[model samples]
Target: MRRVHKALWWASWCWPGCDNQAMLVEKNVPLQSFNSFGILAKALSMLRVRSDADVDALLSNPSLKAVPKFVLGGGSNIVLTGDVKALVLKVEIMGKQLVGETAKAWIVEAGAGENWHELVRWTLESGYPGLENLALIPGTVGATPVQNIGAYGVELQDRFDSLDAIDLVSGQHFTLSAAQCAFGYRDSVFKHQSIDGEGGKPGFGLAGRALITRVRFSLPKNFKPILGYADIEKKMAQSGWNAAAGAPSAMQIFEWICEIRQAKLPDPKVIGNAGSFFKNPTVSLEQCADIIQREPKIVHYPLVDGTVKLAAGWLIDACGWKGKSIGKAGVYERQALVLVNRGDRANPVTGGEVMTLAKAIQTSVYERFGIMLEPEPVVV
Candidate 1:
């Protein structure tokens, strides 16, 4: 392959008479450090995309056009089972700017590869306050919309403006509004597989098809703190704040959230983990009442739609999974929702062990509560 630049270049697999423009590519890349779970794996071939030009060039390359590709973001929400055979596109695109402001909202955009927590901090420091409730979230800005990431009482869709993405198959550029993206509880259209010939058109899912390039958030100009979560309310009480008192500043809420998250969740850097291992299972009120009759102390919350959301952590804890280890994988002691790698770098937890533990937890929870817990991380 002809060299383009020192930093980025085309892969040796380029077809004859291919364009000379260099695209960054690496072979047999180690990926233990890439995923939050610290699972050992390798990518047969990897490409680093720094701009739209890179993606365009990649899609146009004859040799790579037919090869299967995986769009990777922050690597915080995936589990690597083994070596990746598909070409891995590691998005390193980076930029953030205030796009515009309207009468009701401030529009700010960030590249898909930007660190999510850092983006939250940047917005707060730059005088944007609406994202404070999501502070300290791990992963990339691109992954946020895919997961419909939320914490405390604020979700990404609640502050979403729109997003720009490139279709991997058709190489078409498009923008999707919040409604078009179809955000759900810790889920989105991007997480599901599209059905064929459904509804006399294409199906609803976008998983593995679209590459998010940039995301814009509509932070409201009239921001009010979201303090309905129990932890935040406890903090408010401890700080001597009452209903008649003024609302807490965004910075204060941000600090409190950071403190609360740190105390409950294990840092991926220190202890290999994927944050919450499972999504809290939701059930109908009648089903919840039945479960509650058998287990009166079961923790649950009533949703706006009359569904009852049960704490997966509580069920796991009640099953004696807390602080329990299976091989090198274990459930976190402080928070049962998080599965962790008990081994260090020399002998980290294997993806198989992690999945095994996860299945066991699911079986127990289902048997006890009649609720099947779904894993949050993508299993590759």
Candidate 2:
């Protein structure tokens, strides 16, 4: 095996190409520090794969086949409850490309393991404008499609073109177009389906599914930049962005998004968190209208499918869960959507505190607005 670089560690595993006598920490060890949410969990056997060959090598391990296996990105959008019984594979490779760029537009490919917001700033610094509004989004490039991650009125599918993914089953590579990804509001095929086949073998039915190593974006050229979000448009108008529209670079939008995010969400570094805890629940337009008739100030976003996306944060705040504390866990005071770890307590914290608050928010929102808030991270 070639020398591989990985910042995280996982549990030990015996594999074909690896020397059984000498074990590399990067290849297999418990990883409690890599995740932002700070769950101390040991991967039963882990492998941080920098290359496709390393991924294949793990697949070839018969010991890993019968036990569980999981593909992990930056571990930003996950809450690990216990030591993962599965072999957790953390992706750590990085790269970027100006695949195509016009005077006013550009397309780029970002490595799956690259920080999402850092990539956005990179695009902005290089004068590529579209990604600024998405700055500071948590997680890696690979997981973007998993949630079709969106915020402040923009989504990954909006600028997405195509990408390649290895089929964990066939051990072959395939490309997926934006449409083929079956992206929806905060959803994609990967979210509903698992790489491990429940109906078949270990990696069966995993077509365009595996570890996503690279993501290609088809960003706009000569397009009207969106002052799309109401609050953002208001801020931009105040900043004289309307006076010199094209002059407001991606960095401007990046700063705006960062300010908005900082104002709401707690810094994950200071307080362990996985960004937004719940996804905005989508209800039928009529249902939203009914809620609005009762409250008269219900907020919603009109979707193309004619559904109304209700703000999950507003619902949680209205239910009085904001700043509610339980042991070492508490909801963020400023943003009802974020759950924070209180850091100072000796309380035996199970990552389940995130789930408990999520349930409260979910139940509260459902009772108040008839909308069930779906959590963004997989709780296990």
Candidate 3:
């Protein structure tokens, strides 16, 4: 028995050629609806792939040729509206390996399937020092680089070294640099790939077929803390953690961030939410100067380019959308920016509800600040 199982396990990894039905679960799996923002959708087909070989075989399943494909990691950032039409690939792989760590820096790779918070904990325990400020971020490591997730004054591009992704169509895998990702404010090549529905770069067909296998982060071996965000600084002071003296290390920063997140964002398990639903709008420095001249309390974060990033949440709250609940969906009273589904729809509000809420928030923000806040997720 051991011989047969061992041989099969070995084959699953080494062969990369298995087109077997026995390895995959076919149909009848109901995904849990308690995703961070709690909208539920039934998967047309879902597979938890662990190996490159599995990825190859699934892509080759000729029976599924007509269906579109999407990978789900942690399900932390997405808001599933209704029944999905695509084959949802749930990556079940996990583990961590230090591909490279030098005296000056370190590189850590994690499975696309791993949880963001879990990975953050592992890094803290392992003494890595850069991801602290990014603690409590939703989604998986594989998904993180795509959004270039950022918070509390630090962005992913600040630490992103590189990543590996597999092309879904031709089964070709490739590496990407920070530059190739074209990291804008919560945007990347993967999310922004033009759609003829797929990657249509005029002459390119395989322009957008990529599966993020793993992501690597570069971190300083030496202790370097970033303390620009006011909340982080205030919390550091609150926790009696200092940035200068053998003070707030990366682990402490991670904990502080986690604490702050817990206090601010509603637990998705109890309520359905996708965290912050809108991107902070960036405006010209001149526009910012003009606005602040009127409302001196307007908070802004400066960008590398002379422009400034405005807080979308504050703007939404200012528009009086906070505490507004409609049917099963509502905006959290404390956090005006997040859209929450209070309960399952009986006569559930249509996808139109989400749209209406989005439009109202967008219009109000634009009117108040003269800057438009864009939705961060792919609304399909």
Clashes of each: 2, 4, 2
- The best candidate by TM-score is 1
What digit string (tens of lDDT, one per residue) describes model 3 on residues 1-380? 33442112212322234443355533434455525655555675666778776777666656553467777777776666666667777776777778997778889888887888788889889878788888888777888887879888778898888888788776787888888888877877877544554455443222236778888888888877877777787887887765356666687788888898898888876766778889888889899899889878887888788889888888888778898865666888878878887666434334446667888778887787777788876554
Expressed as tens digits, the lDDT of each residue in 1-380 for candidate 2 is: 86645644443665565666333334435555667776666676566667776766656656544555678887888887877766676787689888876565577998888888888888777766777767888888888877788877788888887877876665677888888888887778776554455664353123234678889887776545566788787777777777655656556777878887887787777777888888888889788888888878667889888888888888888888999977667888998888887753334345876677677778877887777888888765
| Tens-place lDDT digits, model 1, residues 35-66 | 99999898988988788877887888787878
Clashing pairs in 2: 10-28, 10-29, 11-28, 11-29
lDDT of 1 at 235: 82
Q: Candidate 3: which stretches are off by over 4 Å? A: 1-21, 32-34, 194-208, 242-246, 344-351
lDDT of each: 0.90, 0.74, 0.74
What is the model-wide C-alpha lDDT for candidate 1?
0.90
Score every model by TM-score: 0.93, 0.86, 0.88
The lowest-lDDT stretch of 10 consecutive residues in candidate 3 is 5-14
Model 2 stretches with alpha carbons more than 4 Å out: 1-30, 101-105, 194-209, 237-247, 344-348
lDDT of 1 at 201: 66
Error of 1 at 374 (Å): 0.7
Better of 1 and 3 by lDDT: 1
